[model samples]
Target: MQKIGILGGGQLGRMLLQAAANYPVETYVLENDEQAPAAHLCHHFTKGDIKDYDAVYNFGRRLDALTIEIENVNVDALEALEKEGITVIPRPAVLRTIRNKALQKNYYTTHQIPTSEYILTHNIQELSEQTHFFPAVHKIAEGGYDGRGVQIIETEKDLSKGFDTLSVLEKMVNVEKEIALMIAISQTGEIAIYPPVQMVFDKALNLLDFQLCPAELPERTYWKAEAIALATVKNFNSPGIFAVELFVTPDGDVLVNETAPRVHNSGHHTIEAHYSSQFDMVWRILLNYPLGSTEAIMPSVMLNILGSEGHSGPACYEGLNEMLKIENAFFHLYGKKQTKPGRKMGHVTVISQERADLLYKANKIKHGLSVITKADGRSG
Candidate 1:
């Protein structure tokens, strides 16, 4: 069996390992926590920091191929591994560009990809000088993910909220709708694109609240999104699955928002709704197998299960029984033992033929299920 190692051991890694069961591959995970979500699922688990050059280098040298659950890993080590002939999915160069917000934006501009205009700043003083760029979004160049490391600078007064480190100040688009397209590319230059999905974020938390697959879009807008997403991934020129988040402006123009170079939350509903899940697609790419179908078996809505406010301790699920009784609902808990406010604990996917049914069930689950701490004796 071919051996593969994954960096980081969060829920993404856990789900990836779950999908690895069907393939003739031995899996390994390197993480700092011994009880990480993916630790027990893999054949081998090494407790080490994914950002440490030596730890990542040593762990990957023994594997036939390597991939990542998160982008904040040691890229230098991945570059070294690629030199040693161990396959690194998506290529280290791609990660280097995507991991930094400034570099990612510059790449978009350089490649002529449709994206919001942005200005790079090295520090707060540099940002203050660009007051005319107010009402923009300030994103730290590196180390930002899942709603963190981003702030909205509505005016000069809000500039203090901007990062003191290198960052990107992007002109916010007049967004009409947010969409995500998942694509998978193979080593031979073949590509497969999943239907674009409509995403709705929890504005307060800046995290994805729920998303509907096969997003309803005007024909022209849908085609535009598809073409732009394909171009973005094609330029990466690497073999791996990618999630391209985009914005649909009021004028019906589609612009690139960001891209994730691995299995993403936006495509999580694929586990039960599509012929080939994102997790399965990643495995196929890693193994050099023919790309699987991205066709949906049914229309679906995925709701994120987040920790309740004022809860922090051992995790507890309230109203889970009620949710379990609902038809066409699939629940996936990440096996995380602790609960903190706004933490992503699990997700529920509801699939149905009718859009009305999908929306009704999704709303019910959104308000019904709650992740809270057993110590608090309260549910959100």
Candidate 2:
């Protein structure tokens, strides 16, 4: 059995481990927590910081192929492993591009791909002349994720809060809506893409609040999302799944926002709604196995279960049975012991053959449920 080494032991890594169990493959997960969800399932477990060079290199050297559940891990060690003839799918070079937003945007420009105009600023002096209007997005080039390290500057007074470190000043295009699509690529040139999904965010932190699969976009928008996502995958030449986030403008313009070269939170709905989930596809890609069908069996909606505000320490879900009263509601909880405000703990997906009615029911479930505290017990 060919062993695959997965970096980062969060829920994504955990699900990947479960999917690999169906095939004749062994896995070694490198993570910091012995209680991480993937730990008990894998063939071997190594508890170490994924960003440390010697730790990551030693882990990659033992596996037949290397893949990651998160992009925050050390790329330099993966590069070293590649030089030593280890098979690191999606290549370490591609990781470098995806890991940094500036390089990622540059990849689009270099390939003649259409993207919003952006200006890079290394220091306070370089950004003396600001062509951008009042409302714009300032994104940190490195180490940002899940609505963090991003700010929407609406006034000159808002600029001070964003002037800390290396950043990219971008035009805050008037976005009509937001959408995302997930695509998987294999070594034999086989490609498959999940139907584009619509994303809704919480107003507070711009955190992903919920997702609806097979977004009810006009035929053209859906096609455009697919086209953009496919182009991104081919450009990366990656051997794994990618979630391509897109922005739909008020004038019906579709622009690429960001890309992730691994299993993504946006596609979590696929577990209940699609013929094959993204975790299963990641395993197939690493094995060089024939790609799976990406068809959705039904229209689905996903609810993100974030930690309650102003609570930490041991966490619990209070209204699970109440939430499951609705038919077709499936819940999956990440085994995180501590609850921090706005932390993503788990998600639930609702699926049905009928699209429109399911949308209504999904929204009801989303509103009626609370991933918050127990009325009687301690906070979270």
Candidate 3:
């Protein structure tokens, strides 16, 4: 049996492990937490820091192929493993470029990809001097995820909120809507693109609240967005799944917002809505199998369950029974014992033939479901 290892055994890895069970493969996962979601599911689980050079290097050496659930893993070790004939999805080079906001923006500009203009700043002092570019989005060059390490600097006064580190000051675009495309590429170069997913953000937390697959976009805008996503993965030319997030302006212009070179939150609905889930697609990529169909059987909406504010420690799910009462509702809880404010704990997906009904149930689930925890240490 072939051996595969994944870095960071979080929810993404957990889902991937579940998918791998359908095939004859031995799976391993390296994570710092013993209680990580994938730990119990994988054939072999090692407790280690994914970012530690020695830990990643040692783990990659024993695998027939290696992949990542998170982007913050040590890329140098992956690069070394690639040189030794072990396959690393997304390619170490791609991760190095995608992990840094400044470098990623530059790649888009170099390829003539439509994206918001950005200025790279070395420090907060330099960022303050760029006040002329006020009302920009300040993003840390690295380690930003789930709306963290990002700030909207509306004025010079907001510069104080930025980190004193390498970052990018991106000119905020006038966005009509936000959407994402899940593109899967095979080892032999075949590609499959899922229909665009419309992202709806929570204004209060600046995090993704829910998503609608097959975003009700005009024909022209939809095709344009697809073109951008295709061009992006082609540019990297690596065999793996990529999620291209985009912004559509009121004038129908499509611009690339960012890309995640792995299974993503926007594609979660695919598990029940599409013929091939993102988890299954990744397995096909790593094993060089023919890519699966990306067709959706029905319209779907996905709601993210974030930890409620002002509650921390052990995690609890409230009103799950009520949320599950909705027709065609599917719940997936990440095996996290503890919860923190704004942390992603789980998600709910709903599907239906009627778009309106699907969206209504999505909102209902969002309101009815809550991830809360008490100060006491135990979780139910």
Candidate 4:
């Protein structure tokens, strides 16, 4: 069987490994934590930092192919592996560009991809000089993910919150709706696109709260969103699954927000709602198999299960049994042993034919489940 290794062992890696059971491949994971979410699921697990050049290089050299669960990995090592004929999905060059926010923004401009306006800042002082660019979002150039490297600079008064390193200051869009489109490209140049999904964020935490597949969009706006998303990913010219997050303005214009080059939370509902899940699509691309169908088996809503506030210890699930009793509801915990405020502990996907039914079940799951610590119980 062909051997493949994945970098990072978070929930994304865990889910990817879960999907690997049906394939004829030996899986390996490289991560520093011996008890990482994916460690036990893979055939082999190496406890090493994914960002260390030597660790990543040595781990990948023995594998036939390699992919990533996160973006902060060692790109130099991936480049070296590619040179030695080890397949690196999406190409190292793509990762290099996507890893840095400034480079990623410049790439959008250079390629004529529709995106928000922005200014690149080398430091806080440079960012201060862009006072006219107030009410913009400040995003650090590298090593930022899941709302950590991003800050809203509403005015000069909020300047202190900006990053002191290289960053991107993007003018915020007059967003009416947020949408995500999942696209997969094969090595042979074939493409498969999943239906767009509407995303709702927990504004306070800057994390996804819930999302509905086959987003509610006017015919014209849907086509526009699709065209823009297609253009954005096609410019990358690489073979891998991509999640293109986008903004729909009141004027019906669609603009690219950001892109993730792997299986993403936005597509998590695909596991139970689509004929081929995002994880399955990634395997097909790596194995050179024909792309699977992206058609949804039913309309679905997915809610993120986050740790309750004031909880920080061994994980506990409240009302899990009640959630399990709900028909057509799928619960997936990340296997994380600890609970911290705002941590993504799991997700629940509810599928139904009627939009009303989907929303009702989603709300039930959202209010019924909580990830907490037994000592703290459910905090206010």
Candidate 5:
């Protein structure tokens, strides 16, 4: 059997493990937490730090291929394993570039890829001195994910709101809408780009609340976004799935926001909406097989289930059954043991050929679902 190892056993790893069950492969996962989402699902689970050189290196030594569900692992170990003939998806160098926002932005500039203008700051003191960058977004150079490590500085007063380390100050362009393009590149160099997903963010949480597939956009805007996404994958030149988020300005300009080199939240709807899901596509890429079709079988909408406010402890889904009452609505809970305000507990996807009906069902699902918990015999 082919042996595969994955780094960081979070929800992404959990879903990948679920998909890998269809194939004859022995899977192992290395995660610091024994209770991680994928810890019990894999054939072998190593409760160790994915960032430790020895832990990651030793884990890859016994596997035919190594891939990461999270990008914060030790790249040095991956490089060593790759040199010893073990396949490392997306390559270690690419990880090194993507893990740091400054380097990622520089790569875009060097490659002539269109992106928002940004300035790198080494410390909070330096960031405070750059007043011209007001009404900007601040992102830590490394270790940022989900809605963490990012801040909006609207004025001088907001300068005290960000990290005091290496960060990027980006001019917040006037955006008409945000969209994501999920692209897959196979090991043999074959590529497929999915239909654009229009996104709407939760202003309070700074996270994607829900998204619509086959984004309702003008033909020109659609084609330009597709071209930019394809160009990004070509520039990365790595095998695996990529989620490229873009900003569409009111003037019809599409600018690169950032890119993720793994299965992303934006593509979650694909599991129920597309001919081939991102999980299946990633597996194909790892095995160097020809990619599956990227066409959407029907229009779909995905909504995130976040932990309820004022509740933190053992988790529970409050209205899942009610939410499931909607036809074609699918729910996938990330096996998280606890719930805290704003934590990603799970997601629901609704699909239908009729755009209006699809959106109507998606809205019902969102309102019906709630992730709440009881702690110390109290709701909070």
Candidate 6:
């Protein structure tokens, strides 16, 4: 069996482990946490920080090929691994570009990809004097995820509240809807694209609240989103999954929002709804195998279950059985140790032929569900 190495061991790594089962391949996952989700499933679980050069270098040194579930890992190690005769899918150069938000935006500018207008902010005074100051979004150049490290500068009050840290300020364009295209590039330079999915965010933090696949978008916008996504992959010369997120502007234009160089939250719906899941896609792509057909097996709506306010401990799920009673509602729990406010604990994917109806049904059950607590003594 061919052995491959995986960096990071959150749910994406865990899901990849599940998918690699079909090929009966031996897998190794390097993770900082011993309680990481993929620990037991992988043939070898090396406990090490992904951002440490020695850890990443040692893991890649022994594998046939290496891939990552997250981009925050040490890129220098990937570059070293590339030099040490290890295959680093999607290429370290691409990962390095996407790892930092500033570098990512610069790549788009260089490639002539359409995106929202942005200005890099180095200090508080600089952020204050910006022309597009009001109603702009503030995003850190690195280490931001799941509603953290991002701020919408709707008012002067927001900027004064400590949201101005190493931020990139951009015009908050009018968006009709938020959408994402989950794409895969194989080592042989083959590509596979999943149907675009419309995302519904929690108004407060911009955290993904729910997503419906095959976004109810016009044919033109659909093709445009796909084109932008493909263009990004081509430019990167990557050989792994790329999740290209976009915004459908109110004026019927699809604008590139951002990109993830690895398995992403936007593509989580593919697990139950697609012919090939992202996990399987990643494994196959890393092995230089033929990519799977990126067809939607069923209409699906996925809901992200975030920890409610005033909660900060292990995850507690409610109404999971209730959702399961409704035909094909599948719940995925990301065995996280804490459930702090806005933390991603897990997600529930409700699949059915009648997508609209299923969405409403799932919403109802989701309302009954609470990853939160009702003044419980134990943190949920």
Model 5 spans with C-alpha error above 4 angstroms: 375-380
CA-only RMSD, every prediction = 1.5, 2.0, 1.1, 1.8, 1.6, 1.8
Q: TM-score of each candidate?
A: 0.98, 0.94, 0.98, 0.98, 0.97, 0.95
Tell me the TM-score of model 2: 0.94
Candidate 2 yields a Cα-based lDDT of: 0.82
Clashing pairs in 6: 90-239
Q: Candidate 4: misplaced stretches above 4 Å?
A: 376-380
Number of the top-ranking candidate, with lDDT as the measure: 1
Write the number of the candidate with greater lDDT, choosing between 2 and 3. 3
**Superior candidate under lDDT, 5 versus 6:** 5
Number of clashes recorded per candidate: 0, 0, 0, 0, 0, 1
lDDT of 4 by residue, 1-380 (tens): 99999999999999999899989999999999988889899999999999999999999999999999998999999999999999999788889988898999998889988899999998999999999878899999999988799999999999999999999999988999999999999989899999999999988889988999989999999999888888888988899999999999999989898988888999999999999999999999998899999999999999999998988988899889888999989999988898899999999899999999888988898888898888655432
Off by over 4 Å in 2: 124-128, 373-380
Q: TM-score of predicted model 6?
A: 0.95
Q: What do the candidate models score in CA lDDT, each in turn?
A: 0.93, 0.82, 0.91, 0.92, 0.89, 0.83
Sort every candidate by TM-score, greatest first: 3, 1, 4, 5, 6, 2
User: For residues 20-49, what per-residue lDDT tens digits would candidate 3 score against the true structure?
Assistant: 998999999999999888899999998899
Clashing pairs in model 3, backbone N/Cα/C closer than 3 A = none
Which scores higher on TM-score, 2 or 4?
4
> What's model 4's TM-score?
0.98
Error of 6 at 322 (Å): 2.1
Report the C-alpha lDDT of model 2 over 306-327, residue by residue, as the tens digit. 8878766567676666777887
3 against 4, candidate with superior TM-score = 3
Model 6 spans > 4 angstroms off = 162-165, 373-380
* lDDT for each residue of candidate 1 in 198-255, tens digit (9 for 90 to 100): 9988888999888999899999999999999999999998999999999999999999
